[model samples]
Target: MAKPNALHTLAELAQNDTEAAARELGRLQGLRTQAENQLNQLTQYRHEYRERMQAVAAEGMTSGRWHDFSRFLDSLDHAIRQQTTALEKAEADLLAGRSRWQNNKRRVNSFDTLIARADAREEKVAARREQRTNDEYAARLARDNASRLN
Candidate 1:
């Protein structure tokens, strides 16, 4: 096992790395959310626009007006497709960020465990030394008292 100081240093570095990873994951999550919101808004707008176009058509619209509505709907459909693709990309990025953060966290936890074990070992050794010193002191006192009485 590594020395206590070395273990502590490693744990500190791992903690820093984990923190950076968490920050990046948070940023990725925010981006994914924004993308999803944009995609949803585009989809809703497309649906409402289509409904409006259908209602107008049912009220008897001209061919030129029909072509205009059709073209606008086509553009909306294109935009929706683009937004969907963006959302998918954002989702993928978020997943990758989450994975990175998880890995970093695992590393930090491992380092923490090692440091804890090192500390426990040190404490056990110190306790044993103290017990030995006390026992020797008691034995000497008993011997000295017996010799003085004799």
Candidate 2:
């Protein structure tokens, strides 16, 4: 019987690692999408606010009202900046996760290849042993026939 492959356990471990990395990549991608959506929402809100402010200004708004609007707009801008930074970080994390998954996949493939080669070698050895046994059996039969003829 062929001996069990020694690297089979390692291959299984690598496969598990690859699966974990893929899950992490998916999670990071989801976070990045959420960040992008939040940024889009903020931008839309900011545009609508500017339009409303402009209409109010045309109707001769008070100075205090103008100051308040300016302060709120500044706050919105700061939030947008922070969200942009968060989106960038999330994208970076997604890229890193993809890299990790790829590396783990490669390791799993390498181990699979090694195990296949080992199985092939064992099969070849078994085939040779079978052939040798057959040859010895044929030789014995021939010698027995020659002795009976003599």
Candidate 3:
């Protein structure tokens, strides 16, 4: 049977790995949130810009001003599209990070199970040894008493 200390060390290492994985997962989630927030802000800005431009046009805007607004709106639309792509990539990364963390957690749990089983087995062996020793001592006393009686 393996030593308890060795099993304990292995379990501790597995736990550390699980913690590291969790931290990495958290970092990835934070990055994903940031990406989402950036995308939402860009979309909102584009909507507000369009509304403001429409209001200005209703006030009899010149052709040059209208052209400038159109170009700026187009750029905002392009930026929004790019941000959407970035958000999608970040989501993908977060999913992968979650998977890694789950795997690590499972590993830690398996190690814990192994340690529990080992301890149970060790206790069972020790109990059996104690019982056997007691039985031998009783037999010895019985033999000694029988010789005296004879």
Q: What is the lDDT of every predicted structure here? A: 0.91, 0.93, 0.91
Identify the candidate with maximal TM-score. 2
Better of 1 and 3 by TM-score: 1
Q: Which ten residues in a row have the lowest lDDT in candidate 1?
A: 1-10
Candidate 1 wrongly placed segments (more than 4 Å)? 1-4
1-150 per-residue lDDT for model 3 (tens digits): 557597788788888988998999999999999999999999899999999999999998999999999999999999988999999999999999889889889988898898889888989999999999999999999999999999
- Candidate number achieving the greatest lDDT relative to the actual structure: 2
Q: Tell me how many residue pairs clash in candidate 2.
A: 0
TM-score of 3: 0.89
Residue-level lDDT of model 1, residues 1-150, one tens digit each, is 446487788889888988998999999999999999998999999899999999999999999999999999999999999999999999999999999899999999998887778878988998999999999999999999999999
Where model 2 places Cα greater than 4 Å from the true spot, the runs are: 1-3
TM-score-better candidate, 2 vs 3:
2
